[model samples]
Target: MSEDPASSRQSSRNQDKTWINRLMSGFSSEPKSREDLINIIKEAAANQLLDDEAVSMIEGAIDVHERQVREVMVPRSQMVVIGIEETPEQLLPTVIESAHSRFPVIGESADDIKGILLAKDLLPLILNGTEDFTLEKVIRPASIIPESKRLNVLLREFRENRYHMALVIDEYGAIAGLVTIEDVLEKIVGDIEDETDEEDEDGFIRKVSDNEYVIKALLPIDQFNDEFGAKFDDNEFDTIAGILIRAFGHLPSRNEHVEIDGFEFRVLYADSRQIHLIRLTIPES
Candidate 1:
């Protein structure tokens, strides 16, 4: 005899309810702290109740609540800005080389930010000709935000206002850095690859100059050794980040540097959880 589909569906719903009830029962009391909540979620994953991705995302969401804009912002020194007085011909190379959709347009100084310029807004000028191009006519209002703003609050504003970028200002109202919607989302989820990201081995380690390189902390120790020709012991730690964390004896914050075997590893981006990016400087032989 064939089983009834309706009966099967009802049975499946009952099973799901039972599983949920069992999971809820395990949390006998409310989680006292974020760490406790994370521990419970991790235990649930260990027991096959929740998946690894779900646990990671939950932890990330909690992390966002504690982080500030300054922690994840692109530092002012690393920001690529377009001078307000620059002609279309002069800015085209910067626009093409940086491959960024939006740029902060500056006036007399870097602190004197005028407005934000969209790359697409310049297409008409390129098509028609730069003979009549005026930056003020094309630039849009800049979204200014404070460096101390929490990431959760910033993310909400980004969604509600439909703005992708914001200029971060310090206590003195100077341009400290810039933050984007992608930067906030990356905290919740993992890295989101865009068109500009290279898909080759060089993608993990990008050369900034003859002595400096930008590297992803997730890059394997073996791959790092292959690139730099260093003899790092990969047996103890799988990734270079692990080795660095061990060397630091604690989680390192952004801009923190440590020297090992004459190589300088400077933290480019990191949170309470782990390091994301690092800048490597090779000592001259």
Candidate 2:
């Protein structure tokens, strides 16, 4: 006789609940704070009741509640935007070069954001005819949000509204930056590499330009030195992130940069615990 799948699933769920209850039973009282709860979870992981990835995800979920949109948004200066007055020929190169799915369409300046232009929306114009193409016709209404909005709330809104991108504004209603669904999700589950991310075969580093590169914080200091022709001490710190953290004296936030030995190291992606990725800009010799 074949085993019942439903019964097997129920047994598995019951076993999971039993272990979870056992883990909680060790606590004399309910967790008094988030930190205490996290400590309990860490203990469970240490005891083999929970895995490392599960602990990380739970911590990330808690961290999201404490973070605001401003913490993870791509700054206005780095935003790749399309001018409303730009022609198809002019904007195509930007769309292709940036490799971004959505771009904010600006009217006069970066402050005067009109709407969002999706790269896929241009397919029909390219195939049919460009003569009838106008950015005003294909642009979608942009979602506006404040920089102070919390990540958890933003994630809920993103799911409920079915939109991916939002323009973040400051107290004065000026565009501060932009945040995406991926950015918020990354806070919970860590980095989500898409097809657009062009990295080396080892996935440790990606050259952005002649003098700039995006690198994983886990890249060994020895390999980094060999790649960049710079001598950084690896005896004290194994990875570039260790050297950076020593220089920073604390866990740095996204977009924060520090110059060490003529090399500009900027935090690209990081959370409460540690830095994940960085942008390295080599100085001209």
Candidate 3:
């Protein structure tokens, strides 16, 4: 992803200023006149200068439509789907097992999805009636996405439109998976947990596939360094994102992969040159 022409020119000006700042990094003696440096900075900013930091942010804006739900999804394997004819006894157990508050009701499998069901909706059925309970009556239809929509755009879509989940589709446009508000939020602010969430030393991280993990970026960087025993260098970056920009050499589009510390970091959403959303895949051993 590249910046707009106006923004690009501004970035060029900013890059020059970075060089100026760097040249001045270890100065033992300050410049004789403060006006010289002040004019340079004022000129750069007045011209709308931007540094590498500006590029990271601009890339997020340019690459919005290219990410997809599957890239940042709660995969089907981890999904909680129930058949339309599923008995309340069967339904209750699935809900309890997942500790999820919602379920998708389908006629046969998840592909034949009829609607979504919230656990609270099941409360009335739990105490009194299993006899007339049907999965179809309690589900909601939601917006869907292809496995190619950009996470940044999706984040805006989610925010402006207030969509909670988007059903991910394959090229043929059938549902291949789903992404939730939590899934998108995980990419941005990192993982979130509730009362029922399980705690493993591997705690809270959901292992959806062999290589893919739903983990919180907030988990201490040192913790990852210690746990995974990786030799990742965090020179100027404190989070996974700072490291990502260092690798790509520029801001990247959504779902674009780069190998770092033996794992593939896929951009889910990046706002302001920072990784607000991402999908991590372990590199092949």
Task: List the global CA lDDT of all models.
Answer: 0.89, 0.91, 0.65
For each candidate, give its TM-score against the true structure.
0.81, 0.77, 0.54
lDDT of candidate model 3 versus the reference: 0.65
lDDT of 3 by residue, 1-285 (tens): 866999989988888777666545523345455445444444444545545434333333333334455656765666778778878877788888888776667776667777777788887874777776676667777576777777777788889986577777788866777887787655444457888876654323456677776555434455556655666766665666567777899877656778876777676544333454556677657
Q: Report per-prediction Cα RMSD to one decimal.
A: 4.1, 6.0, 12.9
Model 3, poorest ten-residue lDDT window? 55-64
Best by lDDT: 2
Ranking by TM-score: 1, 2, 3
Writing each residue's lDDT as its tens digit, candidate 2 over 9-98 gives 998889777768867775768778888888888978886788899999999999999999988898786799999999999999999999
How many clashing residue pairs, candidate 2?
Answer: 0
User: Of 1 and 3, which scores higher on lDDT?
Assistant: 1
**True lDDT of residue 177, candidate 2:** 94
Candidate 2 clashes between residue pairs 3 or more apart in a chain or in different chains: none
User: Backbone clashes per model, in order?
Assistant: 0, 0, 12
Candidate 3 regions with alpha-carbon error over 4 angstroms? 1-78, 96-101, 140-166, 179-204, 234-237, 283-285
